[model samples]
Target: MSDCILEMRGITKEFPGVKALNNVHLRVKAGEIHALCGENGAGKSTLMKVLSGVYPHGTYTGDILYQGNVCRFKNIKQSEEAGIVIIHQELALVPQLSIAENLFLGNEQAQKGVIDWRKTKLETLELMKKVGLAEPADTLVSQIGVGKQQLVEIAKALAKKVRLLILDEPTAALNEDDSENLLNLLLELKKQGITSIMISHKLNEITKIADSITVLRDGQTIETLDVQGGELTENRIIKGMVGRELQNRYPERHAEIGEVIFEVKEWNVHHPLRPDRKVVSDANLSVRKGEIAGIAGLMGSGRTELAMSIFGKSYGKNISGTLIKDGRQLNIRHAGDAIQNGIVYVTEDRKGNGLILMDNIKGNITLSKLNKVASGLVMDERREKHEAERFRRKLNIKTPDIYQTTGNLSGGNQQKVMLSKWIFAEPDILILDEPTRGIDVGAKYEIYGIINQLAEEGKAVIIISSELPELLGMCDRIYTMCEGELTAEFSKEDASQETLMKYMTNRIKKGGEAYADTGANG
Candidate 1:
């Protein structure tokens, strides 16, 4: 028998109206990276929560064995005491505190009554060095980037003497370089005999790092794949995730480019807090009727800032832009004006700004277009439900019903509700910023189909994405932005990963000509 560090046998967990996990079995060997994969609502996180004692003892039916000893932990503290630590998808770090403080937050270095600041700082430095973070221990967590913050999280785990670490979507928010560094760090940890269980939606990352993959579908374990034996592909994983073969990752689209419908000329936006700093430079972009346009750039390249500034004056201060719609220049000062003028923006931060998590799906979907379901300033509850039901069906939003809370829905379904909220508002031009940020592959294809349907309906769609492949696959024309400026534009036939990266990194100086590689015609 293999030296299994952890084994969860016949685990079954249930919520009030949902069966999250059903007799799920997972076995992880010592010092190996075990990957757990599933669709958005496929019980991956729930299982991890149960294992880490977030559900506690007697709440779920299961037997958890760690190193051949059956363990029943009552709380997170108990689990941590047993050398099990879970770093959640949403980071749990106090932004106001220093790295040393966050590293020893719950478990502080103290003697009887007071904390030993000197010892805490010294230990934090050691942990930081172990994680390859070169920052000072006194540095505030907010001062560091997302990549550095992730390292701090791991350091915190190490502080607890974690033997089996569970990471939920660790690289979901990281850029390519940061993600690579984090993955390499995980390998180093494995060499030091630390076991890891990773839950991820990024199939490519899983294929590259995972020694063994355990797939789940609808709260049931599908199969455990030994990737070390070879012949494990993303397509095979997708089949196990969705329970069906996905013929293509991106849906087929027939483009019908028409005359220019919307255009932005000499658009400039200053930073919200620091008016002296310009976030978006004098940029020009346009979209035609029935066209799918894409904005491609590295993170912090002013792509999201540009979209928000155009949607309303929602992002920056001292905005100067000429918005042309159907040969008419319109001044949009607020969100209401933008919506009334047939322009809607689907925000990238769906959990933060897009939807009301506390409210039900019916409420969120009808929020943007409440007037449609209102009678003389009074909401028609029946009409609202009818309208919400229509969108739920149209978008294929999976839930028990439209009455389910938006927060409880999976990432893909929550995104669908966000789209429904905007689409119901009846916008001619839709600006989608990172629409499919943290969703599964099966859901991505569904969203692409929705985009295609919108294009077929002659709506102008602009997608801003960090994924180069997504932009290339979905857009008819792609624009590359770098350092707050538009660097290059390419049609579908002309764009590729390499060509887009060239423009994305090749920055143009202030008041300087375009790069020499991209000629006057380009």
Candidate 2:
């Protein structure tokens, strides 16, 4: 127990055109929760993968020391066998399978190649009890919410006899109550003598649980800090992560708010899967030109659904909404109508819904309006390439040419491509959904600049984000939502995460006492 449980010396990993990790060093002691902190794509995940053998030994230049001895793990199974398990941010659980089945997926309770269902159920129940999850063991993973699915992942780790567990952004999607529950569970695991490594962007959560903190920047490890005994402050952790004193995470912007350019009146959208259930309830919101209005809410809070429903009725059914643009009522029947009406939605998912990964950079940029690239029917290749090239340089897509496939680019570049697609469509009102999600600090800054430029040009910008700090920073005004209802409105001067969250959470219970995340918005 006195020895270091895990150590990686001079670990390095490289991808095409990028060095994912560069000569990094990290160590975790027995029963210690060592937090790995960095912005997105800062090699925190890459270094962990190297230690866990997601990248085979021969692929990276490093030595992994486990439990006072050097270990060569060729695969994830071998690492798990050595009492190591990694729970990725994107959970690997099978949605269709029962929790018990997922827990013992590879290592099942079987004799003569037949599973012992009775024994599996009992074992799963015990594991669930350890994690304090109240769900039945036989419930399908898809039927439960994200928070419960996370517990199942932990249970799976426990089933493998894990000694050191790695959790990547475990609570990124969880609500406040769920996030607190997960953090408490980690402390409980620590009490049981289990060591853990957590990679997260939420500095608040990290400060609450981490024993020691390791900061990584651009594939290199910053000096590790011992944060026990009230030494860990948000200021210190942020300085280490960003490598500079941030006067304000949100950039300075004096609002030049004017008349509302876009407004949604009596908007109600039913659930796409279940039309009888309302996803957005008579939501009324407005964005003024040259002003950034933010929508802040937890996941499944109908923020995205509201945006999608308003953007050409692409999201929900039984949609009863009146959209007004430039002080005139506009009927948006479909996505194309939404675009033609100068309304565009940048989806939260870049790889899944936003961009054509297989297409070249130019193709993606011009995909929204090919008719403009031609006189009548045929797409003029020269004009298409020129349009792609222009936005590629304008948005700083970082590719040599517009011919590059979007899939080959980095996450930030892919996001930029997604943005470029919407910008090329020439929409007057742009709704960005999680625009800076999974992007690094540098990229986020660039994105902020782009957003400012968009607003400065007198376009209406509506930002939807789970990160409260971002809304406080980028948005001139903020709107709070909970349980599919629009609850509170805030001005930047009077807004903070605490004030905003209060309204966001308080709205959960039917018209209960109104509170703000920080305080009253002046």
What C-alpha RMSD separates each model from the true structure? Answer: 1.9, 3.4
Q: Write the per-residue lDDT of candidate 2 for residues 311-348, one digit (tens) a residue.
A: 88888899997888888999778999999989999998
Each model's lDDT: 0.92, 0.86
Off by over 4 Å in 2: 358-360, 372-386, 396-410, 494-499, 506-522
For candidate 1, what's the RMSD?
1.9
Best by TM-score: 1
lDDT for model 1: 0.92
Q: Alpha carbon lDDT of residue 125, candidate 1?
A: 92
Worst 10 residues of 1 by lDDT: 513-522
Worst 10 residues of 2 by lDDT: 513-522
User: Per-residue alpha-carbon lDDT of model 1 for 1-522, expressed as tens digits?
Assistant: 569999999999998799989999999999999999999999999999999999998999989999889999999999999999999989999999999999999999999979999999899999999999998899999999999999999999999999999999999888888999999999999999999999999989989988999999999999999988989988999999999999888998888888899999889999999999998998888899999999998888899999999988889999997999999999898999999999999999899999999999999999997889999899999999999999999999999899999999999999999999999999999999998998999899999999999999999999999888899899988888998898887888888999889788877532255323433223
Question: Residue 291: error of model 1 in Å?
Answer: 0.8
The pairs that clash in candidate 1 are none
